[model samples]
Every structure is written in C-alpha cells, then in structure tokens.
Target: MDIDVFATAHRLEWQRLDALIRRRRRLTGPEVDELVELYQRAATHLSTVRSSGQDPALTARLSGLVARGRSAVTGAHASAWGDVSGFFVRTFPAVLYRMRWWWIGSALLSLALGAGIAVWIMADPQVQAAIGPPEEIRAYVEHDFANYYVEHPGASFAAQVWTNNAWVSALALVLGVFGCLPTVYVLAQNAANLGVAGGLMFAHGKGDIFLGLIIPHGLLELTAVFVAAGVGIKLGWTLIAPGPRPRLQALAEEARAAMAVVLGLVVVLFVSGLIEGFVTGWVHITWLRIAIGVAAEALFLAYVFVLGRKAVHEGETGDIAHRPETAPVAG
Candidate 1:
C-alpha cells in the first residue's frame, strides 16, 4: 500500500490536528476551521490505513489525533439547569403552540363526550339503576366521591396522582406509534368514568359539590391529558399520511417533536396532582378553589401562545438544536 508515501503526504494534516487539540482554548477562528479540516483528513487517513494494512503505530497516532480533534470541534455541553430552563422556555411551549389545534380539538371532543355521557346517565333511569341503587348513588355523591380525595395523606395522594397521570400521558405518547386508536381508547375510558361521576352527582342534587371539587385540579389535569392524546394521535396519523416526506421520516420528525410534550406534561400534571390532593378536599370554599384552577389554566394558555409563538417565529421546532434534521431541498 506504500504506507510511507501516504504517511509523508498526510503528516502535516495530522500534526495540525494535534496542534489544534493542544491549543484549542487559544485558537483563532481561521485556525478552528483549519483544525476541523485537518480532523476530517486525519479520519480519512485512518480509514485508508485500516483498510490497506498499514503499520499499527501510524494508524494509532492518526486515530488519537482525530479523536482529540473531534472533541475540540464539538465543545462541552451546557449545564443541566440550563437545559431544563431551555426546554421550558423554548422547546416545550414552541411545541405546544405548533400543535395547538390538534390538542384543542381533542379537548373539545373529549369534553363533549364526557358531557354527553353525564347527560345520558342523569336522564336515563335504567342507567342509574345499572350503576347502583338510589341510596348507594346518593351516598357516593354525598360522601364517597369527595371522601376519596381526603382518605389518604395529602403528600402520598399527590405522589400517587402524579405517577398515575404521568403514566397515562406517557402511554398515550408511546402507544401513538401504532396509530391513534390506542390513545383514543384510553381517552374514551377516562371520559366515560368522568361522565358517570358527574352524572351521578348531578342526579343526586350535588352538582355544585361535583363541579367545585373536580374543577380545581381537573381543569389543568384534563387539559394536559388532552394535549398528550392529541400529540399522540397526530404522530400516529403522520404514518398514515406523511405528506411530502417519506413515511418513516415523517414519523421520526413527529415522534421527536411529540416527545417534548410528554416531558412538559409531566410538570403540568404534577401541579394538577398537588391541586387535587391539597386544594380540592382541603379547601372548603368552592369559588376560591375553582378560581385557582382557572388561574393555572390561564397561565398555561398564555405561556403557550405567547412564549411559544415567539420561539416558533425564531425557528425553534421543539426538537433539540444539536440533533440532526432533514435538510431542505428544492423541488
């Protein structure tokens, strides 16, 4: 393979990479460019040597230089706190803003379904009987419904709710790959349960108590769930209709973007869990609790439409910046 000839030809490039690695902190901009160029050349040289049965020592030296050069070019990562702040400020909201309509539709449909079920349960005597006897229904409405929240220690209950809600949101996102059918099933089950509870309460003449306790945390909690389901369903639909991109590529892009929602919803659900645990049962005032829930929901909406819009305008797609993206091409 004339190893010596190749070594003599590329020694200068290898040396440059070594020099750049040694003085990475002091390199001028041009020198930094030169370092990257040399790093690329050194990598090529190593590949050629490996394939051509070159001397082991020469191959090892080039390999070390290329490794060091790669590190110098990429630099270190930002702090953990910086990553967390960036996700909330830019990535999370930007995704929420971009995917707003999908979630909004989900919210409307789920709410309507819930309300319809409630109405059916309230008006149909057969359904009420199937649910249970009138006395049991009244007892549940008067006691068991609200008592469920206070039966456990607040902290423990909050933890349980946080974990359960997080799991459900995560399921919607992960199962979305198979098409949105699974996610829809999960949402339907939840809506049905909510409807039965609301209807039972209303039938027993405890409508105010029902809304007062449920509205506080359920507002934000359910919104987060809706968002999760919406994103999941959208991701699934991407497979069915990938637009201009290939199906696999479209799925990858949507999955990457939707994952941000999963993480963001965890925090949202945690806040809701706190409200459900401490505020719903602990706070005896109906109006004040509902007001707190409304305020939290408002803040979430503002954060998405305002900060999210700004980030989207600035070219953030909720995908991590360093990750490889599909390159744009002219048609």
Candidate 2:
C-alpha cells in the first residue's frame, strides 16, 4: 500500500490520457477531472519521495512518459535561437566577470615575452654569428620584405595572403579544443617572429619603414591573436577547475563559450586580412598609416574591452535575460 507507487502510476496514466485528448480525441468531463486528480497525487508523492531520500525512478519514468506522449501529440520541432537566449544571457556575465584577469594577464605576458626574446636574439653577437654572415641575414631580410611574393608570380598576392591569414586563424581556434596548448604554441611562435623582425628593423635603422608597413593591419592582426589565445586559455581552465560538475561536462560547457569567442575572432581576422592585403601595401604615407592604425586600435579596444564587458553585464540582469526563458515552448 505504498501511496508513492500508486501516485506515480496514476500520474503516468494521466499523462497518457492528456496526450490522447490533445490529438483531437474526445474526452468526457469526468476523464479530465480524473487526470487533474492524478497529477495532484503525483506532485504530493514527489515531495514525500524527495524527503525520504529514496530513488525517484517512478517519478522520472512518469515524466519521461509524459514528455513522449506530448511529443506524439504535438510533433517534433527544432529549438529556436530565441528559445535558448536565456542561457547565454545568464551565463556570459559570470564568465566575463571571471575572465577579465585571465585575458589581461595573458596579453601582457605574451607581449613582454615576445619582445624580450626578440631583443635577446638581435643583441647577441654569437646568435647572429650562428645565423651566419651579415650577407646571408641581409639576403633573408630582403627576401622576406620584398622578394617572397615575386617567387609566386601567377597567384594573386592579395588573394593568397587573405587565404593564408584565414586558414591560420581557423587553425588557431580549432586547435584550442586540445587544452589550448597548440593555439598557445602557435601564438608564441608568431610573436617570436614579430619580435625578431621588429628588432631587425630597429638595428638596421629602418624602424620607421617597418612601422609604416605594419601599423595599418598589424593592429587588427595582433588583436585577433590575443583574442584567440584568450579563448584557448578559457577552455583549458575549465578542464582544470570544473566547479561541482565532472571534468568532461565542464569541458563541454567551456567549449560552447570558447566557440563564441572564436566566432568573434574570425570576424576580426577577416577585417585584418583585408587591411593587410589591400591597405597596408598601398598606403605608404606614414601619417595616414599612423592615423588609420590608431583609429583601428581604438575601435577594437573599445569593442573588446568596454562594449563587450557592458554587453555581458546587461545580458545577465536586463530584459534580454528573461526573453528566452519566456519564449513559447517548441511544439
């Protein structure tokens, strides 16, 4: 005479009866009354089961049956973006609030390490000696700046550079799933090269020339790099600290958030590629280049640091946060 079992069984029967009624089927008033009574009984039983610390298998089974019956009556449909917006609204503020330190710290460390390594390589005479004679280094530098594109005469230089930039950006994002180690390595390697090139430009008294060439696009390109690196770090950290969830579940949640960051970075890289291929080489005026570079940097920083932070905060507690949760349930 376990009332819990009786109530659970009745709930299951009531759900089946509700589904039958929804399918344009006829049900007498007494049938509807019976269904309501059963539902109430099940609710009461659930409270008792919860208090007793017993497995609620019967309750879960009833719920599943009810869900299946409803699906049968209404038909399956895909969930809309509007339906899931509440999840993003609730989650982003917490994540952004926690992630600010990681983003800033990683950017500073990467920049400082990259610059330090570059300086060391350029200043050490033995290092230069190991790289071979001055003539060889000069030849390499000239090839990199001027002659590399000449070797591939058929392909459109602009197209090639754009394609290569896109591929590299994508690789950075995809490789981040593997604990972000690969992405970090890629970013570090690129930073090292940039540092060396910058050092060489200064040593040869062509620092101004280098600045004019790189400033226009490098502003966007470098920001893209930092964003990608930050995403990878976020993913890796989730695995390290999963809160109350199991590690695998935590990793999956992190991947979803990291994907959003990657999507944002892709847009950045596309703009950077366009600037690099078309504007950087054509715009030779130092003053114009500086203006464009500074403007672009200001805009990017405003969006990434200021606007992004505000959006996350508003999303968590504003009207936008409730819209998704209140969306019509998919039939």
Candidate 3:
C-alpha cells in the first residue's frame, strides 16, 4: 500500500467509528474505551501495511475511516455570533489597555516635535526674513483662522477636528497591513509640520494663543493617531517574526489584533470630532477650553484604563460560565 493511501484510509475508519458512537446517542465508559482501542489498532495496522509496501485493501478501508471521522467532527451545530461579544470585550480592551504606553509616548513625541519647530522658526533669521513682515504674517494668520468660523458660526469646530482625526486613524489602520513603513512615514511628516507650525506661531509671539486654540481638541486627537500608528507597527512586526507558525497564519493573527485596536479608535475619533466641531469653534474662553479639554482627556483615559480592565475581567468570567462541563464517570 502507498503510504499516502494507507494514512488516508486509517483516518477515514477512525472518523466512521466516531460517527457511529455519536449516532448511537448512548455510550458507557467502557464502550468509549473500546472504540478508542479499535481506532488505535486500525491506525497501527495501516502503518504496518504501508511499511511492508502491501495490502491495498487495508489502505481502502483506512481511507473510508478518515472520511467518517471528518464527518463526525463537523456534524455539531455552532453559534454564528458566539465569538463576537467576547472579541469586543476581551480582545479589544486588552489591546487598547496594553497600548497605553504607545499612546503616551507618541503624544510626548508630537509635543516635542511641535516645540522644536517653534524654536527653529524663532531662531532662524533667514526663515524669519523669508516669512516676510509681521503685518503679512498677521493678515494671513487672521484670515486663515477667522474665515471658517466667521462663515459658519454654527458649525462645530471641534467636530471638524475629530473628523480629521478619523481620517488619519483610518489611513493608519488600512495602510498598516502593508507594514509599518507607511504609518511611520505619515507620522514623521505630521510631526515635522506640527513642529514648523508651532515654531512659526511662537516666533510671532503667538505661542500661548496657538496652544489655546489647539489644546481644546488636540489631546485626544493626537493620542488616537499614536495609538493607530502603534497598532500598525505591531502588525508589521508580526509579519517579520512569525515564530513557529507559518507566515500567513501569523499575519492573520496579527490582523485580528490590529482590528481590535482599530475598532476602539473609531470610538475615540467620534468623540474627538465632537469636541473639535462644537467645543473648539464656539468656546473662545481659555478657562472653558481648559475645563472641557481636561474633562475629555480624563474620560478617554478612564475608558482606556478602567473600562478596559473591567472588560478583561468580564471576559474571564464569561469564558468560565460558557465552558461545557463533563459528567462524572461511574466507578
């Protein structure tokens, strides 16, 4: 018998026997043990026949057994949405909670970049000269800043900011599958631009003014970007180090993890957009901006940390509750 034929036949017989046991709908411990023994014997016989390069009949029998086993295994009904709730509660929260460091690090990095650009623009005489007179800068700045709010007084500036955040986040998540290169490049460019803009504003003695305008919506917006970028990096690295699993299998697993991160980000983007569109546009008071910004930041932090922890706990409890229990055997 050919080795492949023998192996296939051996599997088929085991399957058929398994199906028979299930169909009988009643089995004692000894009966189950007997079935197991028969399966082992069949497998052993198939192996021996293959090694001897004989017994085509044995190979055929084994093939039939394998088919039966497959049928038995797949015969049971399964729930369609059994996995989704657990995924959201356990997997999503775990990913977000664990990634807090990435969010904080990215925010600090963005702030540093912004500060560096502010200093550079302030110190550079040539750049300052190129930027032209103070009147030109003031006129351009006033027009750019005032035009939108002036035209649409009822429009939510906070919401627009949040929308921009969602666009950046979606880009990060979708492009992350390609590896971290795209995400890293995008982050770098954003950081550089922020820095340049900050520097220009500070050089013109508008440092406090700029912060007042940006800080209202920036805290959550910036954190979301970093979290999204971190997720992309993680996905890219999974492809690079698949460990014992096949490359494709590893990639699939990483994609699952990335999806959880992205889902949480959608929530973040929605809230951030609301703040940007509504709060930032209508609220010109510094104290009000600070109050609202702090409250928003606190809410996000609580969601990521406290709510995520609770989700993990709930997942563990659910798993224990849902697991099938086996009956005790008679002596």
Candidate 4:
C-alpha cells in the first residue's frame, strides 16, 4: 500500500492532532473540530495499515496515537528541557532530512546560475563594464571585499550578521506563502550578487583571496540559505498542489512547520556569522581558516543526514510525532 506515501500524506494531520491532544490547555472552536476530524482520519489510517501491511511498528505507533486521542489524549510529559532537546535532536533534523531533496536541488541550481554568471562576466568586457567602472570594481576586488569582514568588531559584527542572515532565512520561508516566484526572486538576486562579486574577484586575480575569506563561513551560511529557499519553495507549492489533502489544510500544516524551521535556522546562521566575523578575517593562516570552514560544512551535512535521517525513520517530522501511550500493549 506504499506505506511511506501514506504516512507522508497524513503525517501533518497526525502531528496536528497529537499537538492538540497533548498540549494547549485551551483549544479554539476550529482547532477542537480539527482534533476530532484528525482523530477519525488517524483511525482510518491505522485500519488501513493493519489490513494492508505487515508493519508492526506502524501499527503500534498508530495504535498509540489513536489510543491517546481516544483517551482525550494524555501524556507523561517530558520536561521542558527534554522537549527542547528533542526538538533539536529529532524534530529539526527530521525536517531537514524531509526537505533535503528540495534544498539540494536549490543549492545546485543556484550554484550553476552563479557559476554561469561569473563565467559570462569574465568572458565579456561589456558584462564587466556593466557591473561597474574598472576602478570601482578593482577596489571592490582588491580591498573592499576583504576589509568588510574586519571593518567591525568581531562580537558585534557576528551579532549583526547573524540577525541579518536569520531574517533573510525567515523571510525566505515566510515569503513562500505568496508563491514560489517571490522565493525564486530572492534566491536569484542572491546568486546574481554572489556571481558578480566572484566574477570581479577572479577577473582581478583575487580569486584565492575571495575563496579563503568566503568558504569558511560561506559554506554553512549559504547552506542555511539554500535550506530556507527550498522549504519556502515547498511551502509555496503546497498552495498549488496539496496532493491528497485539502488546500488550506496543506498550507497551514506547511506554514506551521516553516515557523518551527526558522528557529533552527537562527542557530545555524549564528554559527556561520561567528565564523565569518572571527575566523574569516581574524584567522591569519589561510589553510586553517579554510579547513575550519570545511569542517563546519561537513559537520552540518552529517548532522542533517545522520540525525535527520534517524528522526524521519522514527516518524519524526519537525513536530511532535504521534507517539504511543505509556501503557504496555497487550499481545
């Protein structure tokens, strides 16, 4: 019965229902109605899973979720600290894993566009002149770009850059609702800007300097951005094609996840900002700086592919997974 497809189609409803059942002392009238509807849908899903698949795990998980819903849904609630930890360890990574394809595609497409733009600028004098006058371009390539990192105190700069990047990431996610056009526009502008800078640097024989300064922080920073763009695109697409679910419900579900997704992105960008401010400019050894950047990028990839994959395998989807009740199940 294509269990994965079924789960993906309905997981959001389950998550919403689980949340309504577990938390919130008060539910609005609509939310209460949603809870009841979700409960019924989950029961149908459980029945489907049991009848069509030999997946004991799916059955047990759904059974637990249904049981809780049946019981006006209770909990032996995890501590606030544990909940926070779980959000990072489980929920956040699951979202990353789930959205991996979208972001990866975004990253590849943006990179290709940036590279193409850089090549065009380098190959054509008209393009180069259109970017800027020679003197201004040379100044940017030789001095301004490098000086940007060191112009401000590291701590303050890091904070400022973090806030800015976080806002950009959040904006990318939020703007997804209007349509992918806005999100695509944002990504295109960023790629074009980067391409212009890179083309100018390479043309002026400062390519090494550019990479050295940018890679350490740029790797992780751009990744965070790509993640946002991807999620945003998906959110926008949700409005257009909600698959089996109703359109508004699909949008609401995605929007809720998008909001939570921003919190994790803030932390990701803060790390990138620290590296940009402290390591990119201050670290004297070029190899060491580049190595640090590589390490950060590697670490982030591992975090998503490893922890994120694990979380998804266990049905985590950046929301409270519909878990089984605390009581022992009868054989």
| Highest lDDT model number | 1
List the global CA lDDT of all models: 0.87, 0.61, 0.65, 0.85
Q: Determine which window of 10 residues in candidate 1 has minimal summed lDDT.
A: 322-331
RMSD to truth, every model:
6.9, 7.7, 9.9, 10.7
lDDT of 1 by residue, 187-212 (tens): 88889999999999998789998999
**Stretch of 10 with least lDDT, candidate 2:** 321-330
Kindly list the per-residue Cα lDDT of model 2 for residues 1-331, writing each as its tens digit: 4756766566555565556546434656775565555555544654555455444554454444444444444554336875445334344333444456765665687789778876776688677666557887776565566344244432365567656766766666567667768878877877787887777665666667667777887877776676666667766767777789777766766676665555555566667766666667666677886688778878877654564566665643212221111112223
What TM-score, over all chains together, does every model reach? 0.80, 0.65, 0.64, 0.76
Worst 10 contiguous positions by lDDT, candidate 3: 317-326
Judged by whole-model lDDT over C-alpha atoms, candidate 3 comes out at: 0.65
Which candidate, 1 or 2, has the higher lDDT? 1
- Candidate 1: regions farther than 4 A off: 1-77, 325-331
- State the lDDT of candidate 4 residue by residue for 1-331, as single tens digits: 7888988898888888889987545888887777778888898988998887556677888898887877663445678899889888988888989989989999999999999998888888899998788899878987899999999999999999998888888777778778788988888888998898888888778889989898989999999999999999999999988999878767777776776678889889989999998999999899999999999999999999999999899877775355442223333
Question: Candidate 4: global Cα-lDDT?
Answer: 0.85
Q: Which prediction has more favorable lDDT, 1 or 3?
A: 1
Q: What would the per-residue lDDT of candidate 3 be over residues 103-182, giving only the tens digit for each residue? A: 56656766687677668778996776676776777764555543444355445554555567778877765666676678
How many collisions between residues are there in candidate 1? 0
